[model samples]
Target: MTRREFILAGLGLLGAAAAGGVYSYVHRPKFGELPSGDRLKRMQASPHYHGDHFENLVPVPVMSEDEGGHENRFVATWKFLFGDKKGLVPAHPLPTEKTNLLALPREQDAVVWLGHSSFFVQLGGCRILIDPVFSSYASPLWFINRAFAGSNVYTAEDFPEIDVLAMSHDHWDHLDYPTVMALKSRVHHVVCPLGVGAYFEQWGFAKDSIHEEDWDTEIKLSATLSVHILPSQHFSGRFLKQNPTLWCGMAFITPKRSLYYTGDGGYGAHFKVIG
Candidate 1:
C-alpha cells in the first residue's frame, strides 16, 4: 500500500477498535445495574444527592489546575498509555508473605494489605475486608490493566468469613464483579455509601446483607465494633456517568482502638474537617 493509504488504513482500524470497545461496554452485564424506583427515591432524598447526581460535602474539581482541566484527563490518560514507563514498575517480582487468614486468632488484632485499596483487618472481634478486588485486572476488560506481578497473591479463598465487607466506592478496581460474586457467599455483611448497595442488590445479594449509609452516619456492627461513615472529597461511578452514588471514607472504631480507611478523593477542606 502507498504511505498515505497505510496511515489512513491504520486510522480506520483504530476507529473500528474504539467503536467495538464502546459496543462491548454498553452491552456488558458485569458493568452493573443502576438504582431505580424506591432506591432512586432514597438516593434523591439524601442530603448529598443533588437532583441529577451525588455531591461531596466540599466542592473539588474532578481535574485539577495542574492537570489543565476537564479535557486534560484525556491528555493525561493518553500519556499514561503511551509514555515511557521505565521505572513505573518493579524490575523484579515483588516479594510476598503468606498468612493463614482463617487460622488467625480472633483475639489477635491485625491488618493485612491486599494490594491497592484492598485490606483485611481484625479488630474487636470483627473481621473486616475493605475494597476487596481479586480479579486479575482493575478494568472491565479482562486483559487490560492487569495487576502487577506478585501483587495479586490473595483471593476470596484466602479470606475467612468476612464479618463486614466494607466497600469504599463503586469503581471497578474497588468492586470487582467476579470477586464479589465469589465472596458473596462467604461475606456476612456488605457496608458502603448510600446508593452503592444497588449494585450489590443487582448482584443478587440479600437486602439484609447490605447496609448503606450517608456521610457521618455510624453503623454499630457489634457491641465493640462501630463504623463511622465520614466526609470524603470524592465522586463515584462505574460507567460513563459520574457520581451517581456517594463516595466517602470509613473509620472503624472499636472500644480499644480506631482505624481509618481513606477512599479515593482529592485534597480539600474536607481533609481538615476529617482531621
Candidate 2:
C-alpha cells in the first residue's frame, strides 16, 4: 500500500478507537445523577464541602510536580497501565475459609476479613459489615479490573441480617451495585459518608435506612453502640467527577471497646488527629 494510504488508515483506526472509548465511558451510567437540587444544596452547606466539591481537612496534593516542574499526564498514565504488578495478586488458588456469620456467637466481639477492604464485625451485640464488594469485578464493567480467583468466596447471600452496613466511599471496589441490591432487604441501617446515600436511594433503599455523616460527626447506632465519623485524607466519586461526596474513617465505640477502621487514604496528620 502507498505510504499516504497507510497513514490515513492508521488515523482512521485511532479515531475509531477514541470514539469507542468515549462512547463507553459516557454511556456506562448516569454521570450527573450523583446529588442535585436539595441534596447538593445540603452538601454545599457542609463545612468540608466547598461550593463545587468536598475538601479534606489538610490540603492533600494528589501528585507532586517532578524536578522538571511539569507533570506528564500521558506518560504517568501509560506507566501505571503497564507497571510491574508483583505480589499484587496471588499466584495460586488461595485457601478459602467460610464462617457462617449468623451462627457466630453474639456474646463475644469478633472480626472477619473478607477480601480487599471488606470485613465483618460483631461487637457490642451488633453485627456490622463494612465496605462490602462481593461482585467478581471492581470496575464499571465486569471483565476489566477483576478480583483474584479464590479472593471472592463470600457473596451477599452468605451474609446474615446486617445491623449496620457502613461504606467509606462511593468507589465501586468498596460499594458494589449488585451486592448492595442483594443485601438491601437484609440490611437494616446504612451508614456512609455524605452524598453516598444518594446512590443507595437510587437503588431503592428506604430513606430512613440510610444515615449520611460528614467528617467528625457521631451517630448513635444503638443505646450502647455508637459510630464516630473521623477524617481521612481521601476523596470520593463513582465516575469521572471526584470528591462530589465525602470520604472518611470510622470509629466504632461500644461500652467496653473502641475499634477504628481506616478507610482508603494516604497516611497523613489526620491519623494522629484520629488517634
Candidate 3:
C-alpha cells in the first residue's frame, strides 16, 4: 500500500480498538450484579468514594513553581520515566510498636504509617486502618521478589479488633489477600471505593460488613465520625489489564479532627483543593 494509505489504515484500527475498550468498560458487570455465592451482600456506599474521573487517565497539571527551572527539568522527566519504580524498594523498614506506636491506647487522635500507604489511625475512641499492607512486598508473586526491609510491627494477629477498615483501592499492595482474610472476622466495617468490595466478598467477608461508594460519596460511621471520598490523581491495576478497578484518596473527618490519606497518588491540584 502507499504510505498515506497505510497511515490511514493504522488510524482506523486504532479507532476501532479504542471504541471496543470503551464499550467493554461501560457494559462490564458491576459488583452488585455479581453472584453472592457464600459471600455477604454488597454495601451501598463507601466513606472513601472520590469520583469516576479516573476513567480518563489525565495527568494532573503541575505548577510552574513546583516544576522549577531547566536544572530541575531533568528531575521531572526522570520521575515521569521512573516514578513507578519508587515502590520497587520499600520506603522504610516495617514499622514496629516503638516506631509506629500503634500498641498504645490513645485518648486523643493519632495516626501511624504502617508501611507504603497503610496507616493505623485512632480517633474518638475508634480505630481505623487505611490500605493495610503487611506483606513484605506489594506483589501477587511473593516468592520471586519481596518488600525491601520493614516488617509489620503488628501483624494480622496483633491488630486490635478494628472499628473501620478503609481501603483506598484494590491494588495487591493495598488490599492484601491474607491480611484481609484475617481481618474479616474482626473488623466491624470494610469501606472501599466501588467494585473493591467484590474482592472482599470473594474472600469471605460478610456482605453487611462491606460498604462500597462511588466518587464524592460520603458515609457516616458514627455521630462524630464521617468519611468522605475525595478525588485522587492515580490509576489502578491488580493484574496485567489496567483500570479494571477504581482508585481514590480519603478524608476522615471527626468532631475533633480531620485527616487526609492519599492512598497512592501522583501529586495533583486535589492536594491544594483539600488544603
For model 1, the stretches where C-alpha displacement exceeds 4 angstroms are 1-25, 65-70
Ten-residue stretch with the least lDDT total in model 3? 31-40
Query: CA lDDT, every prediction?
Result: 0.86, 0.85, 0.68
Question: How far in Å is the alpha carbon of 192 misplaced in model 2?
Answer: 0.9
Please estimate how well model 1 matches the true structure, expressed as its whole-model Cα lDDT.
0.86
- Per-residue lDDT value at 19 in model 1: 100
Better of 1 and 2 by lDDT: 1
> Measured by TM-score, how close is model 3 to the native structure?
0.66
Per candidate, the number of residue pairs that clash is 0, 0, 11
Off by over 4 Å in 3: 1-103, 143-145
Better of 2 and 3 by TM-score: 2
TM-score per model over all chains: 0.86, 0.86, 0.66
TM-score of 1: 0.86
User: lDDT (0-100) at residue 202 of candidate 3?
Assistant: 68
lDDT of 1 by residue, 1-275 (tens): 99999999999999999999898777666788788898889889889888889987767667645543345677666676676778888888789886889899987899988888889999988899999888889986665567888888888898888899999899988988889998988989999998899889988999998889988899987789889888888788887888998888999999998998888776777667667
Comparing 1 with 3 on TM-score, the higher-scoring candidate is 1
